[model samples]
Target: MSRLDVTTSVPVFTRPLRSTCRGVPASEAPPLSSAASLVGQQVGHFRLLRELGRGSLGVVLLAEHALIQKRVAIQVLHAHVTQDPARVARFLQAARTLTLIQDAHIVSLYDLGMRDGRPFLIMEYLEGQSLAAFAKGPLAPALVVDLLTQVCDALGAAHAHGIAHGSLNPTSIFLVPDAKGRQHVKLLDFGIAGLLPPSEGAADSPVAADLFAVGVLGALLVTGRLPSRGHAAEEPLHGHAWEVPPLPSDLRSALSRVLLKAMARRPVDRYASAAGLRDALHASVALDGGAAPPESLGLERLPGWYALRGPPGVAPASR
Candidate 1:
């Protein structure tokens, strides 16, 4: 995940400590009026709720729009990082880059602005559990395959826009709840890294960032946990963990190979693009086996093949 250029830590949020609205006398008319007196309360017109998570540069929060009453998730930059203009620009870039993508699976970016001198990226307040929650219990192998394919669709769409979802781990994939509460994967968070560069040039072609992350997420789906920070996930890869989430049985071997290739000691050894690994997954090809993106399954448009993606065990619409 760190190799993806995504910061290797949790999300951190900060607000101005000097604002008069903060550190004010407490009176309980509503959490809002009383909370406004606290540091990092209402950012702009959005009412801050609570912290979601934190990382190297800033924290993410669950907030609501004052007038619209719409729910939103916000990523706020830390005052410390704001001191360095480069980080500030990068913070803004995350939003600008997101505006270029229009995919349903990827978290949708709504607005971009500064609050208390710190910048923020406002996004849809998705309601669901993280893939982290999914992995906590058993994940059917078939469901894993379905989810990965959908992610391929998500990544495929982003790459088409010249964006790389730098971090593609379980923490970044949320299971958006349907009316029935069934699990539907909605990829989230494009904050810490960009898979592609802002311009259409060689400077942004480092796709190993996404390929590596997909491999990591796939590895976790099958293994149900992440490798320790700074630790290479060798034991389970070589064979040790008792629980293994089911994916295509042969998928394990292919995942191992693609992971090694994507995480090559040298980036050059990785697949040229994430689409390449996804192609192999579709064929259910084993390690050492090769496959191409099916001509019918063109990346030019969202794959219509999902209709063939019936329930877990059924055959796709066409061969």
Candidate 2:
């Protein structure tokens, strides 16, 4: 994502390479210290504060700018992965893609560099948990609808730029809360998702893949559990089903129709684009206002009451 002009009142500094490993015996490097030695050290212009989390290929740290105290998230690629040329190229490309996108809903990439031969990414520090945190229960109808709309906007922007968010899981969708009680959605890890090649077929296109994932997310948000097979209650979600919990009477029918179509097994069956989905959702939200029938129903009603007025510059015909 591109950087917005939101002021944090902090002076931005160009991060310098100040590895904590300096002056330490080669045998006692951070690699030997479980990589925790990075804590309390300055990498680039940011001071590594603590380990936020560690994934298969990277370690994310809560970092602070030394001079301005602005907080940021730094993700350092593991040494093993850094050795792979293809992987490193993909990682760098992902960062470039985010920088080019600049979507408000996507996580912003602020900087990129290498430290001791390991590549790292600097990004906006978003405070909140992933959608995974709410996997225990379903969200209310209004809440899910609101979230889905925002995500669609982000996805639409990415699609427009020819970027494909290959992986669209709950863990990657962060829900950040602002000063107000309203929650804001930030799509994360675009680079990680970019490692995969674009799949073939319309159903397998990048846009279609993202929409399919969003459909799964919608189901998860509404049901708390994914559509499941006949398995033990303790097992995680295994199969794909459009099953969602019964929502309020007012929202049930419309929302169900929208989500089911999104989760369609065929790409052609789903919305042609994220914008299409957004329009459909907008209509659904206003369905109670007595608007026209949903486009999903393939209903097209011609005007039943056309004006009988004569052509311009001509007098009206007498009844």
Q: Model 1: C-alpha RMSD to truth?
A: 11.7
Candidate 2 lDDT over 1-319, as tens digits, reads 2111111211111222233212223332233234488898766566778876665566677778767787776667777767777878887887666666656677655666655666666665654555554334555555666678888888887777777667665555655545433456677666664443333332476677777667667766666563221222211111232333453344467777788788777878988788888777666767634333222111121232111111111011111
Top lDDT prediction, candidate number: 2
Q: How many pairs of residues collide in model 1?
A: 15
Query: How would you encode candidate 1's per-residue C-alpha lDDT over 2-77 as one tens digit per residue?
Result: 1111221222111221221222122311232222242356666667776665555556666766786765566655
Stretches off by above 4 angstroms in model 1 are: 1-45, 49-55, 180-182, 194-205, 227-270, 285-319
Q: Give the lowest summed-lDDT range of ten residues in model 2.
A: 310-319
Q: How many backbone clashes does candidate 2 have?
A: 5
Give model 2's TM-score versus the native structure. 0.71
Candidate 2 deviant stretches above 4 angstroms:
1-34, 196-203, 226-251, 288-319
The best candidate by TM-score is 2
